[model samples]
Target: MIRSLKEEIYKFIHQKNSLYGLVALVLLMIYSALTSKTNADSLISVFGAIEWIPIILIAIGSAFFAMEYSNNTILLLLYKNSERSKIYIAKFLTILLYGIVLATTSIITALLLSIVLKSRQYNLFTVIAGKTILIQLGLNILGMIIYSLFAVAMSFMLIMLIRVNAVVICIGLAWGFFGTSLSTALMKTLPTISNILKWNPLNMVFISQQLSKPHYYRVSQLSNLQLIMGTLFYSLLFAILGYLLFRRRRV
Candidate 1:
């Protein structure tokens, strides 16, 4: 398992998209900070850049998984390892590690930007929405960690089923951007089971927003703890199903 993880990490680092994704995240943060109209907006923009992490992670992860099959290298990988489970877990962990890197970059960039752009207005200890900015940032990061797990698992399952990187990426991007809206529409259309639908994975994506703004519960209809648990449940479910499909797939 350790060897497989190391290989995955090596490959992940060498992938051009990994570097490109990191650069895109930093650039987005810079743009958000520079364009903010107010000090509070600047702070929000810093963490707001985190909302894009799922989109970036999905694109990279889909391509990572698809490349092996598209290039006819999956057979070589299986031949080299002969343990499909290790390969799958390693790849998943690599993607999660990448997510962590992106999250860290966002937080560090947010701190630096806050210092440069809103030094007089706020600090990490400053209060926002009744909680310290530091606490809010931590909650945001926690929500992001859970969301990243779901996004990685979902992308893996989609790639396993779809095989085509482009199609998987398109679907993943759509979900990242509009999944919550779709969830809301469904709940309203099916008012009878709206309560149950609130636990859907799409609605779970709002964990980050709900964490930062406690009042967002009115929109998600779920407490922060419930969102965390639901997101985790879906993450595990997708990952397990994806692995099963991967194991049965012919090389």
Candidate 2:
């Protein structure tokens, strides 16, 4: 397992997509910071780049696996490792690691931009929406991590099933961008079962919103703890399904 993980990490580090993704994320943070209209907007913009984490993870994770099959390197990987489970887990972990790197970059870039652009507006200790900026930033980061896990796992499952990177990227991006809105629309259209529907994986993506704005609980119809658990459950579920498909797939 350790050897497989090391190999996966090495591959991820050498991938051009990894560097391009990082650069794109940083540029997004700069754009968000520059376009803020007020102090509150600026502060919120500090975490704005995080909203793109899921989309970025989906693209990178799906492309990583799809590249393996397209290049016929998956056969070499299986021949060398001989343990499909190890390879799958290692690849998943590496994707999660990339998510962590992106999240870290978002936070750091946001802070630097905030200092340069709005140093006098508010400090990290400044209170906003009843919580300090630093605390809100932490919660947002946690939410991004949870959502990224689900995004990466779901992309893996989709790629394993379809073996088409472009389709997988489109599906993953649609879910990442619209899943929460779709969940909200469904709940309103079926208010009677909104309670049950609130537990859906799509609604769990609102964990950050509820965590930062406690009043958002009315919209999500779920507590922060519930959203966290639901996101984790779906993440694990998709990961298991993806692994099963990968193991059964013919090289």
**Estimated TM-score per prediction?**
0.95, 0.95
What TM-score, to 2 decimals, does candidate 2 have?
0.95
Taking the tens digit of each residue's C-alpha lDDT, what string does model 2 give over 1-251? Answer: 99999999999999999998999898877777666553654555354765788888988999999999899999899889898999999999999999999988887887777677755767778888788987887777888888889989998999999989899888877876798899999999999998889888888778755677788888888888888899899999999999999999999
Per-residue lDDT of candidate 1, residues 132-191 (tens digit): 877777777888888999989989998898888888888877887898899989998998
Candidate 2 Cα errors over 4 Å, as ranges: 44-47
- Give per-residue lDDT, candidate 1, residue 148: 90
The backbone clash count of each candidate, in order, is 0, 0
What's the lDDT for all of these models?
A: 0.85, 0.84
Candidate that would win on TM-score: 2
